[model samples]
Target: MKIDIVSVFPEYFDVLNLSLFGKAQAKGLIEVHAHNLRDWTHDVHHSVDDTPVGGGAGMVMKPAVWAECLDELLGLEPADATPDAAVDTATDTAAGKPVLIFPNPSAPLFTQRDATELSHADHLLFGCGRYEGYDARIPAYYRAQGVNVREYSIGDYVLNGGEVATSVMLEAITRLIPGFMGNPESIVEESYTGEGALLEHRQYTKPAQWRGLNVPDVLLSGDHGKVDRFRRDEALTRTNDIRPDLIEQLGCKALDKADRKTLMALGWEVSGEHPRRRGK
Candidate 1:
Protein backbone atom coordinates (compact mmCIF):
# COMPACT_ATOMS: atom_id res chain seq x y z
CA MET A 1 0.00 0.00 0.00
CA LYS A 2 1.05 3.59 -0.68
CA ILE A 3 0.04 6.47 1.61
CA ASP A 4 0.71 10.13 0.87
CA ILE A 5 0.23 12.66 3.68
CA VAL A 6 0.04 16.37 2.95
CA SER A 7 0.73 18.36 6.09
CA VAL A 8 2.29 21.68 7.01
CA PHE A 9 4.34 20.07 9.78
CA PRO A 10 5.78 17.17 7.86
CA GLU A 11 8.70 17.05 10.31
CA TYR A 12 6.36 15.62 12.95
CA PHE A 13 6.42 12.35 11.03
CA ASP A 14 10.11 11.90 11.86
CA VAL A 15 8.88 9.60 14.64
CA LEU A 16 7.99 7.03 11.97
CA ASN A 17 11.67 6.60 11.09
CA LEU A 18 12.45 4.35 14.10
CA SER A 19 9.67 1.95 15.02
CA LEU A 20 7.74 -1.09 13.82
CA PHE A 21 6.64 1.05 10.89
CA GLY A 22 10.28 1.79 10.12
CA LYS A 23 11.02 -1.93 10.06
CA ALA A 24 8.05 -2.50 7.79
CA GLN A 25 9.34 0.23 5.46
CA ALA A 26 12.79 -1.40 5.40
CA LYS A 27 11.16 -4.63 4.18
CA GLY A 28 9.27 -2.75 1.42
CA LEU A 29 5.87 -3.98 2.59
CA ILE A 30 4.51 -0.42 2.36
CA GLU A 31 5.55 3.12 1.40
CA VAL A 32 4.72 6.19 3.49
CA HIS A 33 5.44 9.79 2.51
CA ALA A 34 4.75 13.08 4.25
CA HIS A 35 4.95 16.21 2.10
CA ASN A 36 5.07 19.80 3.37
CA LEU A 37 1.92 21.62 2.38
CA ARG A 38 3.91 24.83 1.83
CA ASP A 39 6.21 23.23 -0.76
CA TRP A 40 3.74 24.25 -3.46
CA THR A 41 3.76 27.94 -2.49
CA HIS A 42 5.60 30.47 -4.70
CA ASP A 43 5.93 33.51 -2.39
CA VAL A 44 8.94 34.70 -0.32
CA HIS A 45 7.27 33.98 3.01
CA HIS A 46 5.82 30.73 1.56
CA SER A 47 2.68 31.28 3.57
CA VAL A 48 -0.08 28.62 3.63
CA ASP A 49 -2.86 30.27 5.70
CA ASP A 50 -4.88 33.50 5.72
CA THR A 51 -7.50 35.29 7.76
CA PRO A 52 -11.00 33.94 7.27
CA VAL A 53 -13.42 35.81 4.97
CA GLY A 54 -16.00 36.04 7.72
CA GLY A 55 -14.91 37.26 11.16
CA GLY A 56 -13.45 34.25 12.96
CA ALA A 57 -11.02 33.51 15.81
CA GLY A 58 -8.54 31.50 13.72
CA MET A 59 -7.04 31.71 10.22
CA VAL A 60 -7.99 29.44 7.35
CA MET A 61 -5.72 27.48 4.98
CA LYS A 62 -5.62 29.11 1.56
CA PRO A 63 -6.97 27.45 -1.59
CA ALA A 64 -4.21 28.61 -3.99
CA VAL A 65 -1.36 26.78 -2.22
CA TRP A 66 -3.49 23.66 -1.80
CA ALA A 67 -4.53 23.69 -5.48
CA GLU A 68 -0.93 24.16 -6.61
CA CYS A 69 0.35 21.36 -4.39
CA LEU A 70 -2.41 18.89 -5.22
CA ASP A 71 -2.11 19.61 -8.96
CA GLU A 72 1.65 19.06 -9.04
CA LEU A 73 1.47 15.97 -6.83
CA LEU A 74 -1.37 14.44 -8.83
CA GLY A 75 -0.21 15.65 -12.28
CA LEU A 76 -2.83 18.29 -12.99
CA GLU A 77 -2.23 21.54 -14.84
CA PRO A 78 -1.32 24.85 -13.10
CA ALA A 79 -4.04 26.85 -11.34
CA ASP A 80 -4.03 29.84 -13.79
CA ALA A 81 -5.77 27.89 -16.56
CA THR A 82 -8.78 29.14 -18.50
CA PRO A 83 -12.18 27.41 -18.11
CA ASP A 84 -11.67 24.93 -20.96
CA ALA A 85 -8.18 23.99 -19.76
CA ALA A 86 -9.45 23.50 -16.19
CA VAL A 87 -12.26 21.28 -17.41
CA ASP A 88 -9.86 19.15 -19.47
CA THR A 89 -7.47 18.59 -16.56
CA ALA A 90 -10.35 17.89 -14.15
CA THR A 91 -11.66 15.26 -16.58
CA ASP A 92 -8.28 13.54 -16.49
CA THR A 93 -8.16 13.68 -12.69
CA ALA A 94 -11.50 11.91 -12.56
CA ALA A 95 -9.66 8.87 -13.93
CA GLY A 96 -7.44 8.66 -10.83
CA LYS A 97 -8.79 10.04 -7.56
CA PRO A 98 -7.57 9.39 -4.03
CA VAL A 99 -9.53 6.88 -1.94
CA LEU A 100 -9.25 8.32 1.59
CA ILE A 101 -10.01 11.61 3.33
CA PHE A 102 -9.63 13.00 6.89
CA PRO A 103 -12.36 15.47 7.65
CA ASN A 104 -13.60 17.53 10.60
CA PRO A 105 -16.01 16.74 13.47
CA SER A 106 -19.01 16.19 11.20
CA ALA A 107 -17.90 12.77 9.89
CA PRO A 108 -18.52 9.32 11.28
CA LEU A 109 -16.61 8.05 14.32
CA PHE A 110 -13.58 5.96 13.29
CA THR A 111 -13.21 2.36 14.45
CA GLN A 112 -10.84 -0.63 14.28
CA ARG A 113 -13.13 -2.05 11.60
CA ASP A 114 -12.65 1.09 9.49
CA ALA A 115 -8.89 0.76 9.83
CA THR A 116 -9.08 -2.86 8.63
CA GLU A 117 -11.07 -1.80 5.56
CA LEU A 118 -8.63 1.01 4.64
CA SER A 119 -5.55 -1.19 4.95
CA HIS A 120 -6.55 -2.94 1.70
CA ALA A 121 -6.67 0.24 -0.42
CA ASP A 122 -4.05 0.78 -3.14
CA HIS A 123 -3.54 4.44 -2.22
CA LEU A 124 -4.62 6.74 0.61
CA LEU A 125 -4.27 10.52 0.80
CA PHE A 126 -4.40 12.36 4.13
CA GLY A 127 -5.11 16.10 4.07
CA CYS A 128 -3.81 17.59 7.28
CA GLY A 129 -5.18 20.97 8.31
CA ARG A 130 -3.79 23.49 10.77
CA TYR A 131 -4.93 26.79 12.35
CA GLU A 132 -8.67 27.17 11.80
CA GLY A 133 -9.07 24.56 9.04
CA TYR A 134 -8.88 23.88 5.30
CA ASP A 135 -10.71 26.05 2.81
CA ALA A 136 -14.29 24.71 2.78
CA ARG A 137 -14.15 24.44 -1.01
CA ILE A 138 -11.47 21.74 -0.89
CA PRO A 139 -13.76 18.98 0.36
CA ALA A 140 -16.52 20.13 -1.97
CA TYR A 141 -14.13 20.05 -4.93
CA TYR A 142 -13.03 16.50 -4.13
CA ARG A 143 -16.59 15.34 -3.67
CA ALA A 144 -17.68 16.88 -6.99
CA GLN A 145 -14.94 14.85 -8.65
CA GLY A 146 -16.41 11.62 -7.17
CA VAL A 147 -13.58 10.78 -4.77
CA ASN A 148 -14.26 8.90 -1.54
CA VAL A 149 -14.17 11.72 1.03
CA ARG A 150 -14.57 10.90 4.73
CA GLU A 151 -13.89 12.57 8.05
CA TYR A 152 -12.82 10.65 11.16
CA SER A 153 -12.08 11.45 14.80
CA ILE A 154 -9.74 9.69 17.20
CA GLY A 155 -11.98 10.55 20.13
CA ASP A 156 -14.36 13.25 21.28
CA TYR A 157 -11.62 15.76 22.02
CA VAL A 158 -9.88 18.13 19.53
CA LEU A 159 -6.22 18.37 18.60
CA ASN A 160 -4.05 21.23 17.31
CA GLY A 161 -4.04 19.66 13.82
CA GLY A 162 -4.89 16.48 11.98
CA GLU A 163 -1.29 15.17 11.69
CA VAL A 164 -1.35 13.58 15.16
CA ALA A 165 -4.75 12.08 14.49
CA THR A 166 -3.56 10.85 11.09
CA SER A 167 -0.52 9.27 12.70
CA VAL A 168 -2.72 7.44 15.19
CA MET A 169 -4.88 6.14 12.35
CA LEU A 170 -1.93 5.21 10.10
CA GLU A 171 -0.30 3.13 12.83
CA ALA A 172 -3.54 1.27 13.44
CA ILE A 173 -3.98 0.39 9.77
CA THR A 174 -0.33 -0.38 9.01
CA ARG A 175 0.01 -2.95 11.79
CA LEU A 176 -2.82 -4.96 10.25
CA ILE A 177 -1.13 -5.38 6.85
CA PRO A 178 -0.04 -8.99 6.19
CA GLY A 179 3.80 -8.78 6.11
CA PHE A 180 4.17 -5.86 8.50
CA MET A 181 4.97 -8.10 11.47
CA GLY A 182 7.60 -10.78 12.05
CA ASN A 183 5.10 -13.42 13.18
CA PRO A 184 1.77 -13.19 11.31
CA GLU A 185 0.04 -15.32 13.93
CA SER A 186 0.58 -12.56 16.51
CA ILE A 187 -2.14 -10.47 14.91
CA VAL A 188 -4.80 -13.18 15.04
CA GLU A 189 -4.25 -14.17 18.69
CA GLU A 190 -3.78 -10.74 20.31
CA SER A 191 -6.37 -8.84 22.31
CA TYR A 192 -9.40 -7.28 20.50
CA THR A 193 -8.90 -9.02 17.13
CA GLY A 194 -12.05 -11.02 17.95
CA GLU A 195 -10.65 -14.58 17.82
CA GLY A 196 -12.57 -14.59 21.09
CA ALA A 197 -15.13 -11.93 22.04
CA LEU A 198 -13.03 -10.53 24.90
CA LEU A 199 -9.74 -8.94 25.89
CA GLU A 200 -6.64 -11.09 26.51
CA HIS A 201 -7.24 -12.81 29.85
CA ARG A 202 -4.81 -12.81 32.78
CA GLN A 203 -1.37 -14.23 31.97
CA TYR A 204 0.97 -15.86 34.51
CA THR A 205 4.70 -16.37 34.22
CA LYS A 206 7.48 -18.83 35.26
CA PRO A 207 7.06 -18.51 39.04
CA ALA A 208 4.28 -21.11 39.22
CA GLN A 209 4.11 -20.84 43.03
CA TRP A 210 4.94 -17.20 43.75
CA ARG A 211 4.21 -16.19 47.36
CA GLY A 212 2.40 -19.51 47.71
CA LEU A 213 -0.18 -18.41 45.11
CA ASN A 214 0.06 -21.26 42.62
CA VAL A 215 -0.41 -21.01 38.87
CA PRO A 216 -3.39 -22.94 37.56
CA ASP A 217 -2.32 -26.58 37.41
CA VAL A 218 -3.74 -27.11 33.90
CA LEU A 219 -1.16 -24.74 32.34
CA LEU A 220 1.78 -26.42 34.10
CA SER A 221 0.40 -29.90 33.37
CA GLY A 222 1.02 -29.33 29.60
CA ASP A 223 -2.46 -30.53 28.83
CA HIS A 224 -3.40 -28.35 25.83
CA GLY A 225 -7.02 -29.49 25.93
CA LYS A 226 -7.54 -28.38 29.53
CA VAL A 227 -5.50 -25.20 29.00
CA ASP A 228 -7.71 -24.04 26.13
CA ARG A 229 -10.85 -24.48 28.21
CA PHE A 230 -9.33 -22.61 31.18
CA ARG A 231 -8.20 -19.62 29.09
CA ARG A 232 -11.59 -19.26 27.37
CA ASP A 233 -13.49 -19.42 30.62
CA GLU A 234 -11.18 -16.90 32.29
CA ALA A 235 -11.49 -14.51 29.34
CA LEU A 236 -15.29 -14.78 29.45
CA THR A 237 -15.32 -14.19 33.20
CA ARG A 238 -13.12 -11.07 32.90
CA THR A 239 -15.27 -9.71 30.09
CA ASN A 240 -18.45 -10.19 32.05
CA ASP A 241 -17.06 -8.22 34.98
CA ILE A 242 -15.30 -5.33 33.19
CA ARG A 243 -16.98 -4.97 29.81
CA PRO A 244 -20.47 -6.39 29.95
CA ASP A 245 -21.22 -4.77 26.60
CA LEU A 246 -18.89 -7.30 24.96
CA ILE A 247 -20.75 -10.11 26.70
CA GLU A 248 -24.07 -8.76 25.42
CA GLN A 249 -22.73 -8.55 21.87
CA LEU A 250 -21.42 -12.08 22.26
CA GLY A 251 -24.17 -14.60 21.55
CA CYS A 252 -24.66 -17.82 23.53
CA LYS A 253 -22.08 -19.36 21.19
CA ALA A 254 -19.40 -17.28 22.91
CA LEU A 255 -20.20 -18.95 26.20
CA ASP A 256 -20.82 -22.65 26.81
CA LYS A 257 -23.58 -23.86 29.14
CA ALA A 258 -21.19 -23.68 32.12
CA ASP A 259 -19.92 -20.19 31.24
CA ARG A 260 -23.53 -18.98 30.82
CA LYS A 261 -24.37 -20.34 34.23
CA THR A 262 -21.31 -18.56 35.66
CA LEU A 263 -22.48 -15.25 34.19
CA MET A 264 -25.99 -15.77 35.54
CA ALA A 265 -24.51 -16.40 39.01
CA LEU A 266 -22.90 -12.94 38.76
CA GLY A 267 -26.39 -11.46 38.08
CA TRP A 268 -25.69 -11.10 34.34
CA GLU A 269 -28.47 -12.55 32.20
CA VAL A 270 -26.90 -14.20 29.15
CA SER A 271 -29.84 -13.35 26.87
CA GLY A 272 -33.58 -12.55 26.54
CA GLU A 273 -34.07 -10.38 29.62
CA HIS A 274 -36.99 -7.97 29.24
CA PRO A 275 -36.02 -4.26 29.46
CA ARG A 276 -37.94 -3.67 32.70
CA ARG A 277 -36.68 -6.89 34.29
CA ARG A 278 -33.08 -5.80 33.64
CA GLY A 279 -33.05 -3.48 36.67
CA LYS A 280 -31.09 -0.26 37.03
Candidate 2:
Protein backbone atom coordinates (compact mmCIF):
# COMPACT_ATOMS: atom_id res chain seq x y z
CA MET A 1 0.00 0.00 0.00
CA LYS A 2 1.05 3.57 -0.67
CA ILE A 3 0.12 6.30 1.82
CA ASP A 4 0.51 10.03 1.30
CA ILE A 5 -0.10 12.38 4.21
CA VAL A 6 -0.46 16.16 3.76
CA SER A 7 0.04 18.08 6.97
CA VAL A 8 1.69 21.29 8.10
CA PHE A 9 3.54 19.27 10.72
CA PRO A 10 4.89 16.56 8.48
CA GLU A 11 7.60 15.90 11.08
CA TYR A 12 4.94 14.45 13.38
CA PHE A 13 4.93 11.31 11.26
CA ASP A 14 8.68 10.73 11.55
CA VAL A 15 7.92 8.34 14.40
CA LEU A 16 6.50 5.92 11.87
CA ASN A 17 10.08 4.88 11.31
CA LEU A 18 10.50 3.52 14.85
CA SER A 19 8.12 0.61 15.31
CA LEU A 20 6.30 -2.26 13.60
CA PHE A 21 5.27 0.17 10.85
CA GLY A 22 8.91 0.86 10.25
CA LYS A 23 9.55 -2.86 9.92
CA ALA A 24 6.73 -3.15 7.40
CA GLN A 25 8.20 -0.31 5.38
CA ALA A 26 11.60 -1.96 5.53
CA LYS A 27 10.17 -5.15 4.12
CA GLY A 28 8.44 -3.17 1.34
CA LEU A 29 4.92 -4.10 2.51
CA ILE A 30 3.85 -0.42 2.64
CA GLU A 31 5.18 2.91 1.43
CA VAL A 32 4.54 6.14 3.33
CA HIS A 33 5.28 9.80 2.60
CA ALA A 34 4.41 12.91 4.57
CA HIS A 35 4.33 16.24 2.72
CA ASN A 36 4.00 19.73 4.11
CA LEU A 37 0.74 21.24 2.97
CA ARG A 38 2.40 24.64 2.74
CA ASP A 39 4.64 23.28 0.02
CA TRP A 40 1.72 23.72 -2.36
CA THR A 41 1.45 27.45 -1.61
CA HIS A 42 3.18 29.98 -3.84
CA ASP A 43 2.94 33.16 -1.75
CA VAL A 44 5.80 34.56 0.29
CA HIS A 45 4.14 33.46 3.55
CA HIS A 46 3.04 30.16 2.00
CA SER A 47 -0.28 30.70 3.76
CA VAL A 48 -2.80 27.85 3.57
CA ASP A 49 -5.70 29.31 5.55
CA ASP A 50 -7.90 32.40 5.46
CA THR A 51 -10.69 34.00 7.43
CA PRO A 52 -14.02 32.30 6.75
CA VAL A 53 -16.15 33.99 4.12
CA GLY A 54 -19.07 34.25 6.57
CA GLY A 55 -16.78 35.51 9.37
CA GLY A 56 -16.03 32.42 11.43
CA ALA A 57 -13.94 32.51 14.65
CA GLY A 58 -10.97 30.64 13.28
CA MET A 59 -9.30 30.58 9.89
CA VAL A 60 -10.42 27.91 7.44
CA MET A 61 -7.94 26.05 5.27
CA LYS A 62 -7.79 27.19 1.66
CA PRO A 63 -9.37 24.94 -0.98
CA ALA A 64 -7.04 26.05 -3.73
CA VAL A 65 -3.93 24.92 -1.81
CA TRP A 66 -5.47 21.53 -0.96
CA ALA A 67 -6.68 21.06 -4.53
CA GLU A 68 -3.26 21.68 -6.01
CA CYS A 69 -1.58 19.28 -3.56
CA LEU A 70 -4.24 16.59 -4.01
CA ASP A 71 -4.28 16.92 -7.77
CA GLU A 72 -0.56 16.41 -7.96
CA LEU A 73 -0.52 13.48 -5.54
CA LEU A 74 -3.65 11.80 -6.96
CA GLY A 75 -2.35 12.25 -10.50
CA LEU A 76 -5.44 14.09 -11.70
CA GLU A 77 -5.84 17.08 -13.95
CA PRO A 78 -6.99 20.31 -12.32
CA ALA A 79 -10.77 20.61 -12.02
CA ASP A 80 -10.73 24.35 -12.91
CA ALA A 81 -13.22 23.90 -15.74
CA THR A 82 -15.13 20.99 -14.19
CA PRO A 83 -18.84 21.35 -13.55
CA ASP A 84 -20.26 20.90 -10.03
CA ALA A 85 -21.93 17.60 -10.89
CA ALA A 86 -22.88 14.88 -8.46
CA VAL A 87 -20.23 12.39 -7.50
CA ASP A 88 -19.78 9.80 -10.22
CA THR A 89 -21.00 6.22 -9.84
CA ALA A 90 -17.44 4.97 -10.42
CA THR A 91 -16.61 5.86 -6.81
CA ASP A 92 -18.76 2.89 -5.76
CA THR A 93 -16.03 0.61 -7.10
CA ALA A 94 -13.11 1.84 -4.95
CA ALA A 95 -10.89 -1.17 -5.35
CA GLY A 96 -7.33 -0.18 -6.31
CA LYS A 97 -8.33 3.50 -6.30
CA PRO A 98 -6.71 6.26 -4.31
CA VAL A 99 -8.93 7.08 -1.32
CA LEU A 100 -8.76 10.65 -0.04
CA ILE A 101 -9.45 11.15 3.66
CA PHE A 102 -9.90 14.20 5.82
CA PRO A 103 -10.05 14.23 9.60
CA ASN A 104 -12.95 16.32 10.88
CA PRO A 105 -14.28 16.63 14.39
CA SER A 106 -17.92 16.77 13.33
CA ALA A 107 -17.86 13.86 10.92
CA PRO A 108 -18.86 10.30 11.68
CA LEU A 109 -16.50 8.40 13.95
CA PHE A 110 -13.90 6.28 12.27
CA THR A 111 -14.27 2.58 12.99
CA GLN A 112 -12.35 -0.65 12.83
CA ARG A 113 -14.65 -1.80 10.03
CA ASP A 114 -13.63 1.26 8.00
CA ALA A 115 -10.00 0.46 8.64
CA THR A 116 -10.50 -3.11 7.44
CA GLU A 117 -12.23 -1.87 4.32
CA LEU A 118 -9.60 0.75 3.47
CA SER A 119 -6.76 -1.69 4.04
CA HIS A 120 -7.46 -3.17 0.62
CA ALA A 121 -6.95 0.09 -1.24
CA ASP A 122 -3.73 0.36 -3.24
CA HIS A 123 -3.17 4.02 -2.37
CA LEU A 124 -4.39 6.32 0.39
CA LEU A 125 -4.14 10.11 0.50
CA PHE A 126 -4.87 11.78 3.81
CA GLY A 127 -5.31 15.54 4.07
CA CYS A 128 -4.84 16.77 7.61
CA GLY A 129 -6.69 20.05 8.02
CA ARG A 130 -5.73 22.58 10.64
CA TYR A 131 -7.26 25.67 12.30
CA GLU A 132 -11.03 25.68 11.86
CA GLY A 133 -10.84 22.98 9.11
CA TYR A 134 -10.57 22.93 5.34
CA ASP A 135 -12.99 24.46 2.91
CA ALA A 136 -15.91 22.06 2.45
CA ARG A 137 -15.65 22.55 -1.26
CA ILE A 138 -12.34 20.66 -1.38
CA PRO A 139 -13.89 17.27 -0.69
CA ALA A 140 -17.03 18.10 -2.67
CA TYR A 141 -15.07 19.08 -5.75
CA TYR A 142 -12.90 15.96 -5.53
CA ARG A 143 -15.96 13.75 -5.15
CA ALA A 144 -17.48 15.42 -8.18
CA GLN A 145 -14.35 14.38 -10.05
CA GLY A 146 -15.08 10.76 -9.07
CA VAL A 147 -12.56 10.60 -6.23
CA ASN A 148 -13.34 8.42 -3.23
CA VAL A 149 -13.38 11.13 -0.60
CA ARG A 150 -14.09 10.42 3.05
CA GLU A 151 -14.10 12.56 6.18
CA TYR A 152 -14.04 11.02 9.64
CA SER A 153 -13.68 11.92 13.26
CA ILE A 154 -11.69 9.62 15.46
CA GLY A 155 -14.00 10.18 18.40
CA ASP A 156 -16.66 12.52 19.83
CA TYR A 157 -14.17 15.12 21.01
CA VAL A 158 -12.24 17.84 19.15
CA LEU A 159 -8.52 18.07 18.53
CA ASN A 160 -5.98 20.82 17.98
CA GLY A 161 -5.36 19.57 14.48
CA GLY A 162 -5.77 16.55 12.20
CA GLU A 163 -2.18 15.40 12.72
CA VAL A 164 -3.01 13.19 15.69
CA ALA A 165 -6.18 11.89 14.14
CA THR A 166 -4.34 11.10 10.95
CA SER A 167 -1.73 9.14 12.88
CA VAL A 168 -4.39 7.19 14.76
CA MET A 169 -6.21 6.34 11.55
CA LEU A 170 -3.03 5.56 9.67
CA GLU A 171 -1.94 3.01 12.26
CA ALA A 172 -5.40 1.46 12.38
CA ILE A 173 -5.62 1.05 8.61
CA THR A 174 -2.06 -0.05 7.94
CA ARG A 175 -1.88 -2.61 10.72
CA LEU A 176 -4.70 -4.50 9.05
CA ILE A 177 -2.81 -4.74 5.79
CA PRO A 178 -1.45 -8.23 5.03
CA GLY A 179 1.93 -9.01 6.63
CA PHE A 180 1.86 -5.82 8.77
CA MET A 181 1.74 -7.66 12.05
CA GLY A 182 4.10 -10.27 13.45
CA ASN A 183 1.13 -12.32 14.67
CA PRO A 184 -1.64 -12.18 12.07
CA GLU A 185 -4.15 -13.81 14.39
CA SER A 186 -3.63 -11.15 17.05
CA ILE A 187 -6.20 -8.87 15.43
CA VAL A 188 -8.85 -11.54 14.87
CA GLU A 189 -10.60 -11.55 18.27
CA GLU A 190 -9.93 -7.92 19.20
CA SER A 191 -12.56 -5.50 20.42
CA TYR A 192 -14.78 -4.03 17.65
CA THR A 193 -13.90 -6.97 15.40
CA GLY A 194 -15.77 -10.09 14.25
CA GLU A 195 -19.50 -10.50 13.60
CA GLY A 196 -20.62 -9.45 17.07
CA ALA A 197 -18.14 -6.58 17.54
CA LEU A 198 -18.01 -7.40 21.21
CA LEU A 199 -15.35 -5.99 23.47
CA GLU A 200 -12.54 -8.50 23.71
CA HIS A 201 -12.42 -10.93 26.58
CA ARG A 202 -9.87 -10.12 29.26
CA GLN A 203 -6.44 -11.60 28.79
CA TYR A 204 -3.95 -12.91 31.40
CA THR A 205 -0.40 -14.07 31.07
CA LYS A 206 1.69 -16.65 33.01
CA PRO A 207 2.02 -16.47 36.82
CA ALA A 208 -1.73 -16.91 37.06
CA GLN A 209 -1.77 -15.21 40.42
CA TRP A 210 -0.64 -11.60 40.27
CA ARG A 211 -0.46 -9.11 43.13
CA GLY A 212 -2.71 -11.54 45.09
CA LEU A 213 -5.30 -11.61 42.29
CA ASN A 214 -5.59 -15.00 40.68
CA VAL A 215 -6.39 -15.63 37.04
CA PRO A 216 -9.70 -17.30 36.26
CA ASP A 217 -9.52 -21.02 37.03
CA VAL A 218 -11.18 -21.91 33.75
CA LEU A 219 -8.21 -20.46 31.82
CA LEU A 220 -5.86 -22.75 33.69
CA SER A 221 -7.86 -25.89 32.96
CA GLY A 222 -6.63 -28.05 30.11
CA ASP A 223 -10.14 -28.26 28.66
CA HIS A 224 -10.16 -26.00 25.59
CA GLY A 225 -13.93 -26.32 25.16
CA LYS A 226 -14.63 -25.05 28.68
CA VAL A 227 -12.02 -22.33 28.23
CA ASP A 228 -13.60 -21.12 24.99
CA ARG A 229 -17.04 -21.10 26.57
CA PHE A 230 -15.75 -19.16 29.54
CA ARG A 231 -14.10 -16.54 27.35
CA ARG A 232 -17.21 -16.14 25.16
CA ASP A 233 -19.46 -15.68 28.15
CA GLU A 234 -17.10 -13.17 29.70
CA ALA A 235 -16.86 -11.28 26.43
CA LEU A 236 -20.63 -11.05 26.15
CA THR A 237 -21.00 -10.11 29.81
CA ARG A 238 -18.32 -7.40 29.56
CA THR A 239 -19.72 -5.96 26.38
CA ASN A 240 -23.23 -5.82 27.78
CA ASP A 241 -22.11 -4.26 31.03
CA ILE A 242 -19.62 -1.79 29.59
CA ARG A 243 -21.09 -1.14 26.16
CA PRO A 244 -24.74 -2.13 25.88
CA ASP A 245 -24.79 -0.34 22.54
CA LEU A 246 -22.67 -3.12 21.11
CA ILE A 247 -25.11 -5.63 22.57
CA GLU A 248 -27.98 -3.76 20.91
CA GLN A 249 -26.19 -3.99 17.57
CA LEU A 250 -25.77 -7.76 17.86
CA GLY A 251 -27.95 -9.83 15.55
CA CYS A 252 -30.06 -12.57 17.10
CA LYS A 253 -28.54 -15.04 14.66
CA ALA A 254 -25.09 -14.37 16.06
CA LEU A 255 -26.20 -15.76 19.38
CA ASP A 256 -26.98 -19.38 20.21
CA LYS A 257 -29.19 -20.70 23.04
CA ALA A 258 -26.37 -20.43 25.53
CA ASP A 259 -25.63 -16.83 24.49
CA ARG A 260 -29.32 -15.94 24.64
CA LYS A 261 -29.60 -17.25 28.17
CA THR A 262 -26.60 -15.21 29.19
CA LEU A 263 -28.01 -11.99 27.69
CA MET A 264 -31.53 -12.60 29.00
CA ALA A 265 -30.05 -12.99 32.47
CA LEU A 266 -28.46 -9.57 32.00
CA GLY A 267 -31.87 -7.91 31.27
CA TRP A 268 -31.53 -7.86 27.48
CA GLU A 269 -34.60 -8.72 25.39
CA VAL A 270 -33.99 -10.58 22.15
CA SER A 271 -36.72 -10.12 19.57
CA GLY A 272 -36.23 -11.60 16.13
CA GLU A 273 -32.66 -11.01 14.93
CA HIS A 274 -32.18 -7.83 17.00
CA PRO A 275 -31.59 -7.49 20.69
CA ARG A 276 -32.80 -4.47 22.63
CA ARG A 277 -32.19 -3.18 26.14
CA ARG A 278 -35.42 -4.69 27.40
CA GLY A 279 -37.92 -1.75 27.59
CA LYS A 280 -36.47 0.30 24.73
| TM-scores, one per candidate | 0.78, 0.95
Model 1 C-alpha RMSD vs. true structure (Å) is: 5.6
lDDT by residue for model 1 over 210-241, one digit each (tens)? 99799988899888978887887777678767
Best by TM-score: 2
- Count of backbone clashes, every candidate in sequence: 1, 1
- Per-candidate alpha-carbon RMSD to the true structure: 5.6, 1.8
Question: Model 2, range 199-230, lDDT digits (tens) per residue?
Answer: 99999998998899999999999999999889
Judging by lDDT against the true structure, name the best candidate: 2
Pairs with steric clashes in candidate 2:
252-273
TM-score of 1: 0.78
- Model 1, C-alpha of 195: deviation from truth (Å): 7.7
